[model samples]
Target: MLVRRFKKSLLVLSIAASATVAHAESFNRIASFGVIHNLPEGTEQSQETSPEIIAASEDGNTLVYSDSPFEALGFVDISDAKNPVAGGIVKLDGEPTSVAIGGKTVFTAVNTSKSYTQPSGYLMALGLQERDELVRCDLGGQPDSVAVSKDGRYVAVAIENERDEDLNDGEMPQLPAGWVTIVPVENGQLQCDKMTKVDMTGLAEIGATDPEPEFVDFNSRNEIVVTLQENNYLAIIDAASGKLVNHFSAGSVELQGIDTKKDKMLDFTDSQTRLREPDSVKWLDDNRFVIANEGDMNGGARGFTIFHKDGRMLFESGASFEHQVILAGHYPEKRSGKKGSEPEGVAIGQFDGETYIFILSERASVIGVYRDTGDAPEFVQLLPSGMAPESAVVIPQRNLLVSANEKDLIEDKGPRAHVMLYSLTDAPAAYPQIISTRTSEGTPIGWGALSGLTADPAKPGMLYAVNDSFYANQPTIFTIDANQTPAKITAATLVLRDGKTAKKLDLEGIAADGQGGFWLASEGKTSKEIPHAIHHVNSTGEIDRTIDFPKALLANEKKYGAEGITLIGDTLWIAIQRPWKDDPADQVKLLAYNLKTNSWGAVRYPLESAATGWVGLSEIVSHGDQVYIIERDNQLGESAVVKRLYSVSQDQLKPAAIGSDLPLVKKVLVHDFMPDLKSLNGYVQDKIEGFTVDAAGNGFAITDNDGVDDSSGETLFFSIGKM
Candidate 1:
């Protein structure tokens, strides 16, 4: 077993600056957003910006972030190298998410929101001091990625704006006006002052929602290449005049979250998701570029593709890249395990000059690990775990690998995921095996525990995991013996409203109190679909005989998707992944539960990034004053290989006990092993499902998936800190 350990926060690996970028700097590292999930009762999480981040910043040095408007840029100053201080953030008329720095000036690709028009151009020239302001120029609606000219004379903006949001009646908005705009900048300001916009209204006949012109960039000769979100043709525009040159399409990339073969905790719709329209087109060196074809545009992020500047194919993401499965049978034998095939999530890691990918395949019930060599990915093998595997992460800084698992029964997949760990070592086989534990249901209890696993901050041999066993089939809680051999017996017991198994009850999220206790939360079972709520069950793993969560969040399934739970300082944070149709502005609904006052405050925010399938918010964890939330795709439960990791401010979940002296939970992904890894090159992979953080700030995750044979149970182990 290869020991997978969760790394500590601040462990960032810098990407050596490349001279090929011509006007290139470096990738942003640490991005410590100053917001908190600790919203008050009857409120939502505090969020300031909405421009979703096109890329997450790592390395804790430079910041590659997308601000509220939808533009991506880099920040130079970071605090503690690990604890990044929002040193400098920039934005313009367009939202900032993806940015490329040339020389000292940063070219940002931004797009306006639905209620507006006219995507704009943003240019920034960093002075010797690194202080800069944004110079905005009109680009067009919903621009694609941006590229710079080697001659430093022009900046190309890809415009694929097909207004599809406002259907007037019910028609999908398709901005047939696909065009490329060339705006010249001298001294960091628009020199042309006049943007040369190319016209592409022809695609409107195809009926793609706003399938406008996209992929604007200059070739080696300074000629521009543009592609649309819809259609196969790449439209070429005259770089100098911004005139339409030619149109053609090679193939397409598939956009997805993680590999399904590795993860087994999420809800899937059909057998699986297919590739959809592509987004995020980047030029790979001058001739080749990479495009992420978001299959499930609704945040499904399936896979990606590489293309040549002349509309030729380089490579596309493939499930069959380097995978070799044992072949349960003629067609995968439908893994038969106690835990049904409830797909977990997936994870991607960059280490040892290679990309380590993992997934949780609950049905086959194995944790899969793989490696992608940039050209193609290859399958490694399948590890064992408890029942179902959910979510996992790999943080190299701390040299740790953690997974969260839960126990439950649904459909044929068998039981829910479980909590497991593996200590990452210098060697490959150091991966830890699953520590078998007996569930509270000892009647030869078929499956294992539902998961919301997290490492403890205060104790050495302890961990807190959650389950939905206690409620009317609702989620519940559990505690594991961290020091026991193979993680010892479940010795697991968690309190849920009177400690009775009520039908239709919901208990999913769990976090450590930093002292010897734990925090447990539950969603409303079935009563009028009471809004999801948070509960601060003590460390004894018992439910609080005192407070009520429903009253605290005033949660309603209709408005907010308050499904996931976590704790950051004194605040108990709840995640609302689904926004209410009536209230589109509600980006994040986080209820800051004050541990001291034991009260709830409201801090709501909107998001520019995408979301999961929006079933039940899965789990929440805090690492280094930052809060992380886990969301599932949908009910079908098709575990993808990787999971989505987002960061929130410690101020949001202000753990009431911290006095300016102590630190909030600080944990990060060091290693992630799960199911369904073949998608990423690993065979025997399982889905990683849940996540947890203990009092000591260490991290742990639970993962599960259908087994390849369809009759086996596999779980793996992963840990956070020294304990």
Candidate 2:
């Protein structure tokens, strides 16, 4: 019995270690292509564009995606996988909903409907090599998804004919009814006259008279599976004869341990039963298929489900996938009230004899990879995608996976719509550089928007980080163990005031008080009633005291204040984010408060001038005799040119009165963070907000994800080695 117990313990340790270490084979992002690059020469660059559904050519050298906002089809040449070139866009007569490739031809489903009541569309085929329209078959309804059979003999399109949400709160039964259209393909050409229309009315229990098909997929047996998202129904039809083979309710799931409130907190104790209104379906084989439960109208299961062709539930992800997303710090807390990390797209691929399943989370902007093990799918790794991933296409032959990200943040001046590429390689996963561990109740410790970091005074590789105002109601200090490959967040301590979670604190910087306490810097916006103050919290996370800025400094204050805090002897130094009304051009204040004297003074820090946007200080940390600061710009992607680390000597700590002329400190370049940001193969992030040096003298940096709001939800945490 003793030997058996020892062996069991060893097995558990082995499994845990394997999970933390790198896998022999994994997927890493190789490149990212912005769909705006495919805009025509005469088109305005500022115009909005979105890549909704994507397809790859047979040779795997070219990619075609539907740009609905531009009303065109865009193409990309990936002959050089690492550097994709624009193949330009083809103008279309209507909005292209989806696209599928068959040999040297591409079939696109175009929505020509003028209104919800009068629905009409067509399936247009164009030559991939010549870029010329070959044929068009009137689909007679608004189509949503299009798929070509594995045998390349048939094409299936789902005629959604969706209802108007303004009509009756988006309720069903207001439609002219939807159906499935299957067209024959002979000798690699679409035969428009031989299209078959399959009637799907009165087949579903909900909205029986108005069936709205959302997505379609084909199996090896030439059978098509259709998802009626609003009706919460699934139907299987024979593509060859247009006969109903089987149909069943998509069903509901009892979800537990989920966040169901938009209260800006990561509470995962709620329970609710919701319908699995699946959006995208893909067949694993002729016998089984998978559905992404994206939910619409009245339901969203918040995960994926697998079902047998005969309607047996094989596996239900429930809240497991969302939990993993929470651990990765990609959970969209703003979407907590609705479908948390709504799984909307699913793709299946067989690479080197191993079948893998890719599930795209629409809100979280992350892809969850799983290996199909016949009975149950095993969770693999999560890949960071562009903002709002809408569809995915896997090129197994080239060991490549591509995702179509439909969000174009042109209005917000954020990252544009992008299509990201990843390749399977013999290396470790490079994302989620930091992840949180489970709590005592086995629930993931939810964390995001890590705005500030401070190293534990005595423990090497141990750090504490604080979230910004993005999580306003649940101000938290996360304890991270950086000794692991992917740094692990071990515990979360909520910043509480009088036994309740603190309110109105926009915490951005943290510093160890050296007496089992911490000093927090809260950036304030007076317009929102938040004050620019410093808070002292006990080891138990209870606020003990608050220090407000002097009236002299407040006279010319801006909303961007006190971005970072650090302690040196009896003085606490703060780095202001941007210039105030009283400050000179290209300079910001680094305020100093003497605890012993109870007085405030200031020094001016010179900022690098940016060509496009303004530059500002993000973080400040004191190590040995140097004070390191993180200086960055507000630009993203290729426009970001200034994300660097600089340091000033502690001897330059002389400060003058708040209204006096502040002494300008000379800084020496410590490092350039642009290369580090590009090392992940993602677009350059704008906020590199946190930096700290551990007891062992190693430097670590982190980026804020803005709580996944209009962002990619990728929190990059990495080390700069000994500093």
- lDDT: which candidate is best? 2
Q: Please give the CA lDDT of all the candidate structures.
A: 0.43, 0.90
lDDT of 2 by residue, 405-431 (tens): 998999999999999999999888988
- Model 1 TM-score, all chains together: 0.43
**Candidate 2 local Cα displacement, residue 3, angstroms:** 57
lDDT score of residue 534 within candidate 2: 97
Q: List model 1 lDDT by residue over 1-723, tens digit each.
A: 000000111222221111011111111111112211111234332223222222222332333334431232324333243333434444344455334444456566655545425433343333313545556565535555566675666787666554534356324453345566687766655564667766666543344345555444455667766655554345556677766655545343332222243222221111333432444344445565554442212222233445555655556543221111121110122221111232223445555455555555433344555555444434443444433343343444543333433222333433322223333334333222333232333211112334456666666556655544322332334446656433533444535456663333355556666666666555554445643555555655455633455432342345334455666656677655555432344244555666688665544444433343333345566667566665433332233333434455666443332111212333344343333222221223333456655555655555443323332333434554422
Q: Return the clash pairs for model 2, or none.
A: none
TM-score of 2: 0.97
| Model 1 worst lDDT window (10 residues) | 1-10
TM-scores for the candidates: 0.43, 0.97
Worst 10 contiguous positions by lDDT, candidate 2: 1-10
> Would you give me the overall lDDT of model 1?
0.43
